[model samples]
Target: MTSNMKTQVDDQMVLLSQYYPGIYDQLIPEQGEVVKPRRRRKKNKADGNSSMMRKRKLSDEQVNLLEQNFGNEHKLESERKDRLASELGLDPRQVAVWFQNRRARWKSKKLEEEYSKLKSQHDSTVLEKCQLESEILKLKEQLSEAEKQINSLVERSDGISSTSPCSSFSMEAMEPHFLGGFGMEGLENVFCLPENNYIHGSLDWMNI
Candidate 1:
């Protein structure tokens, strides 16, 4: 082969060697300074392959725009996927996967919000219950105090009623002594008189 042909062949071999490391290395002619084959880049199956095994990824901008335009709560992920697929020039499967992931994320966020609201409600209910319990306890104490006061008053009334008639009799006996001190000696002597005489004397004294 001419020098130009040989050079062209060598260039092709180098290109091939870069693509297939072990296979091309053995077949290619060793010349000036064997070019070490670059380490083959690992092919990302998701990006490079057209197979169904690949997981779909969505751009943040696209996802955010979708959520803004069509609410994250849009039901029917399949329908949303079809619509987004038409807009973004992506496969329906990819859109479907994206929607599935987005829905899961949205659901988790919504559940967290609901949990917070319920927790707040529960806390408020507990506080109200405690306040009500305190009010009930206060009422019970007031009722107990009122009952005690009523009992005390009843006992005092019983004592006073039972002793009042006796007290009035003793007062009548002492009244004559008070009148005698005021030059009512006859009124004092009337108390020592017979019962019938005393009644008549008391009646006369009352009339005067």
Candidate 2:
């Protein structure tokens, strides 16, 4: 059948099911585009005969025992599963399904914890890196200031040398003046020169 014709038929079936809720399953086949089955009243009834097919809630004691087993091993041998089922008064199938669900939840929780730890470590490392970068910038600024101070000192030294009259005087020429308080006579005797000759020689040197 064409697409349009198929849609029309599906619509009609839906209208019929709404009117007659009881015979909807009988009217439709299971082959193409099957409709969802309605909840059966028989299954929902609290009867002992169909209770085995329904989900069974585990008690606190049973849950604690199962968790203890899971702590030991994620997988259980068939014999162990049967033993646990007998002890808990549950079916072997139910015990197996419980283990499967518990293991999945445990694995998910472990992964989430590991992710949080790694993320914290990464944040700490990033913070340390930023602190180090800030320190380096401050050190660079201090070094730049020191360099500027040294340049200023050098410029002042050059200016003083250019302006001072005795800037070109050697250490030998300045030594006598520095020791003059001892007496010019003592200085002349130390150098073996007469006072007048020394004075005239110093004057001629200064003129040159």
TM-score attained by model 1:
0.46
Expressed as tens digits, the lDDT of each residue in 110-206 for candidate 1 is 9999999999999999999999778756644554555455456556766789665433333245446644554335433233433454323213433
Q: Rate the local accuracy (lDDT) of all candidates.
A: 0.62, 0.68
- Lowest summed-lDDT stretch of 10 residues in model 1? 199-208
Model 1 residue runs over 4 Å out of place are 1-57, 76-80, 162-208
Lowest summed-lDDT stretch of 10 residues in model 2?
A: 183-192
In each prediction, how many residue pairs overlap at the backbone (N, C-alpha, C within less than 3 A)? Answer: 0, 0
* Residue pairs of candidate 1 with colliding backbone atoms: none
Steric clash pairs (candidate 2): none
Which model scores highest in TM-score? 2
TM-score (all chains, Cα) for each model: 0.46, 0.50
